[model samples]
Target: MELRHLRYFVAVAAERSMSRAAEQLHLTQPSLSRQIRQLEQELGVVLFERTTTGTALTPGGAAFYHHARLLLRLAEASREAAHSAGEATREVVDLGIPPGLSPDWVVRLLGLLRDEVGRASVLITEANSAEQLRMVREGRLDLGLVHERPLQALTGTRLFSQPFGLAVRPDHPLAARTECTLRELHGLRILAHGREQVQAAHDALIVAAHERGVTPLWRFAQFSEHARSCAEATESDAVVLTENSARRLLPQWPWLRLAEDSVDLTTWLIWQPATRTVVTRVAEVISGLAEPVTVPR
Candidate 1:
């Protein structure tokens, strides 16, 4: 019925003498005998044939011997395996990253984590903020880096803020400006991502225009790929993100420019108690790298 009973039975069955088994198991003979009697009672079958020479297994005892031995060995093996996995898990940390985050930040975060934790084995996943948040909650991810406003249910530490602006080809007239007002390009096409946030961004820009007594024309690009495609297309005065996204694409696409005026964005790192140590170390590394870099005001 219980593991201890199985242990006592296996020991007695292997030794074949209650006296010898008790000596080996460090128990009194009567105590061992009582345990065997209890085990037989629970199973409703006699296990041992008592003889003047020694104890022998009954027919039922022989059959149960094989199964009980296997069960005991399997239980031991499971405990060992679980212990090994737990040891490895203690040294590993998994992180979930937002899909649109720059590869540079991802690489930086991983390198920092490895150096900080030494034995850290990192697993990385790329998903949207919503998906990453869910993964963190479900314990599939230890932490996440995202740009959405922090949910009340989830605690987060803000990392950095970036401005939103138009990305354009170098040949575009707006690209040559040292600085320009929103009204200068009142009727130009625009590209942007996000559903509600993009709309919010648009409204903010429109409000900026209204403050300057001008109206700007725009269209929404729901994904980064679409925004990039619009930027590469000819006659594309497409609205574009003026955020730090440009910094990420600069190495590969060196011709994108920040449009005159746009909103700014902030990013955060989110995690729960289980990931506190790793996240704190990571935040320290990010903070060190995030030194006061100058940006357009």
Candidate 2:
């Protein structure tokens, strides 16, 4: 089958609505529906079924969705490989994002990079703010989203910030609260990221406590590559996290905002002087996506 059929199928599956998918593809609803029907006819399977809420994928459609996405990604990589023929070497941009960054943003970024970076391959790595800063300075990373502004080692742009939230266990006292104050945390064991991952944030928490004369028992860890950190923190009174990180890591837990008066933790997009063209382009796309966001209960 042609690649357009696969592309149309993927888009429809993602949107779960023929009309919305057609709108995104810049085609009429009827045209998009006809294309999908032709694809299903060729495959001899019913791909989508109408549901009360929206279009739902059939069993075959659900299975095909995973393969179709991989095939499209492979197709893009192949084109990039072919386009690098005349060059001495292919360009690859290594980008580092903090653990607290939103997964939705990461997916959006990959899609943007594929469309914008002409002949370069972009790779994403998960690193905390301090690690990202160090990697950017040591030339291990081309771009980084860090929690603090870097010094002489790397140049930085203020992008955005996410306020801290609490992931409290169901049994915890604060679990049902819509928002929490520092004073409420007094005498409770509050789990947080260690200095290795976010020194500035750690210091800010301490300062926030001192300012309010509220002292909660502090427990810290350098979160590993996965959501195991959430599991470990469940033993504590509550785990401090941003909304995005809490949602991505441990969606089952009860999350509430930690609204403090004077605490600030900002994200800075970092890059070295004379960064590559592709690196700057991808960074610009990330910068464009930056805006102050807050999670609603």
Candidate 3:
């Protein structure tokens, strides 16, 4: 029998009088009787006993009542669950970020996402610029912060262009200088992230240094903890990285800026053009960030 039959049976059993049950259901008494009769006939069981006092349930009716109520409750729960799933799918946004983004920037982005996007939540995945770009292009990531050159394939906005710097020990001779060119760093061993981490930016800086008739000892490390461990183990005199990374990874040491205009790292925010509106909102917030400044002291 249909759900309406179960409902009619329930109402009649609850009220005990057919006329009162019909009133509550907004159906005429004859219509209500016909519906109840249809349900009993479909089940091939007598669900109610008629008498002068009032209508009452049979033993069979009592048994069916519990099962009918339970079925209605389950149906309602299923509908609510489906609706909630749809809402969650719409509200969650996936974001990819490269390593060494400042904690302040991360916090600011997260806070703004909560306040501005309202019910949206961000799922952050950390990968290098290359991987992040690929993820964004492949539609796996809703938004990405990458260091690679802008592509015609995806929508992008440049957020910061931080010059590279050298982090050296206090006693190092270069520590006294605020900034120096790659040509000036001749013969000194310098550690940096490999091309695997920031392929375009790293390669460009190396090529520029070579073109300037400078060839220094090049040491390669990954990011943060790995770089620190390698610095302690190797004879590399200085660490070459962005100002943000240098300050966080080698705090208390001197940061010497590389004077060559081309010897710097730039970051961009990239996303698919047709992505969810929440992703576009997040991109706008990031693009509004003030360009980072370099401090050499």
Candidate 4:
């Protein structure tokens, strides 16, 4: 019921053990149990299924867990807003990232921002492109790096757009090929990322098969995870990724190869116009940092 209860609940759910959660919270097991019991009573539902193995969320508990996370994030945001003035003089920016960007890109960009801005606190949030855009629009994030074009409903500055390509393992049969066509991919498997728009794009590719309408087997993955996983595992024959993302992964792995033909995916810096001045400055810093990322043809 209280903020502390939500905090404890989140800890317990995340750790999956009351004792571990208690230890992390610097509380005794008994106190943690009491807090959980009180929380369950207030909610009128059991939030966790306790067993010898550990605590696991029931269906209702799983649903409450999502809301609990959102509440905690909002609480942190509130504190940031309350302490805004003191921190305004300090340069700290929170950047949200969508799928398709390599984690290395994030590391490189964070270092770039810190070196350029000086004395910056950088926070990263990874989500689907749509969700990342929504957070920027909601004023919950200073700026977002998305793997798609800017939405008409939102105003944003362009970062870069890279060509999308079919990614495959080096040893795979398709790796020997120089170029591959969407229609030629009939009966072959492919991995795809994103929600709504990206999903629709993937579906379009599958539906556009010239004949036989062969469905490309899909393995759902979140932001760079899927492409990397499928490529490493050799699970699906290919995965759709931006050229920057492909090149980012290829150097280290060396086994993942890209087909010559590629689609274009754009990365953009999205923000709300009505955002506060401090947040606006943060966005400006991010936009400047991304100025040189070339959009692939």
Candidate 5:
């Protein structure tokens, strides 16, 4: 019935343990349990199934969990909107950027934000696509640059599409090649960003390599610098990176385009539909920078 009850339920659903949720909520276990029981009694349905391991959501609980999260998000957004309206002296926008994004794009975005947003200050956070999506949905970030399309009901503007490529050290045999086939990557030690960080790109690479009968030893890292270091230390034959990232991070090395025609690397500018005016202007500036390119992948 109350917002606090919804918050408690959400916390319990997330943590899956009464004690842990109580600790997170800063409430005693008994009090939290009592509140949950009151909520279930009011709703006339069981929410959580008690077990030795922890708590598991019942069917009713799972449905309620989804709606509870949405309600909480809407409440937070309302508060933020009111706060922003009250403070007319200055504006602040929170933006999220994924790792290994092209430096040039970041520079352009920052320049546009400064020019269009006037005196508004922008806070930048480095996060993966999934993390950015969550932040945007939870009202923590006003905008995000992500590699994958969001599954949620958020607005995403398509940016330029990047072509996939392989980055090889100058000493590597493949470095001299203008283009490399996925089949040629077999038996090579490869490095790339982890799937959790860039799920779509990583999945595309895996599928393309598998189709070509190539299964290179994959070493994954969260950051491009770490991937590069691992590749150098292990004498990796190549690192799978976008053409733009390779040019920026490893220009000294040779970047060979992948011959696979099915792989596409695209970046999207994502934000909630009800974003603020300043955030909307920022997104418009980014959208005007480049039209969506159709890479023949």
Candidate 6:
């Protein structure tokens, strides 16, 4: 009827003597005997037979002993499993990253996270900023790196800012210049990422080029791989990208900063407001890694 009843029944059946079981259980002989009698009554079965030598099991007592021992073992195993579950020490954090980002930066961030959160595992997914923002809003991703602050109910922090630069083939005339103005890129065919892939950055470049009175014929591709293929096939005059990404993604080409100071690119770290503590800690590490560096013009 109860766990204690099963335990008492098993102990009494094992020792075959009321006094011995009582001594082992730290219960009075009368108390232990009464408990065993109550168990037999509840089951309507005779268990132990009184004997002049020592108590002996009746036919029913032998059968009950087998199941009673199993029940006690199962209960102990269940308790241990529950306690282990409550003390779980590891956590997994899912992070989304934009494509064409600097690999070196990502490696450094991952290393820092591993060191700081020893019990945390990181899962990385590559997606564009706009897509990453949508995934974070939908609760599919715990954190993301995006080009602009998300307009959704999520929280965001600025990670770092980079200047826009031109990537061109080695033989291109612009490759020889250390820097060039947006206005000077006019009349040249250029390869650019699609508006949907990086909405904020793409729109900003378009608006800045328009304000500078430059209207290059722009060829748009939806993904970084496609944009790179287009640039190689068409031998386009140049492709625009952040200085860090340009150097890592297309190292064969030369990267030249845009002479216009206003053409800066910024990256933000975004996550759901209810993100786990591990994700928040990782965000802090990223913010610390974003300190500015001075580069001579």
| Rank by lDDT (best first) | 5, 3, 6, 2, 4, 1
Q: If scored against the real structure, what TM-score would every candidate get? A: 0.56, 0.65, 0.66, 0.55, 0.65, 0.66
Per-residue lDDT tens digits for candidate 6, residues 153-180, read 9888876677777888778898888898
Model 5 alpha-carbon drift over 4 Å, by segment: 1-88, 294-297
Q: Where is model 3 more than 4 Å wrong at Cα?
A: 1-90, 260-262, 290-297
Give the Cα error of residue 150 in candidate 4, in Å. 3.4
lDDT string for model 1 (246-286, tens) is 54543233333335654555566777655557555655665
Q: State which candidate has the highest lDDT.
A: 5
Candidate 2 TM-score over all chains jointly: 0.65
Worst-scoring 10-residue span by lDDT in model 3: 288-297
For every candidate, C-alpha RMSD to the true structure in Å:
12.9, 13.0, 12.9, 10.0, 12.1, 14.0
Which scores greater on lDDT, model 1 or model 3? Answer: 3
After TM-score superposition, what is the CA distance of residue 228 in candidate 1 from its true location, in Å? 3.1
lDDT of each: 0.67, 0.80, 0.82, 0.70, 0.83, 0.80
lDDT of 4 by residue, 70-113 (tens): 99999999998888767546655677887556566677777776
lDDT of 3 by residue, 102-143 (tens): 777787778887887776788999988888888988898888
What is the lDDT, from 0 to 100, of the residue 186 in candidate 5? 81
As for candidate 5, its clashing pairs are 261-297
Candidate 5's residue-wise lDDT over 1-297, tens digit each? Answer: 999999999999999999999999999999999999999999998999988889999999999999999999999999988888866565788889887776666877788778887756888998889899999999999988888986568998888777778889889889889798888878888888778888998998898788767888887776755656777776777888877778777888899987754466777889999877878887888777655663222
* lDDT string, candidate 2, 215-252, tens digits: 88888777744544644644577777777777767677
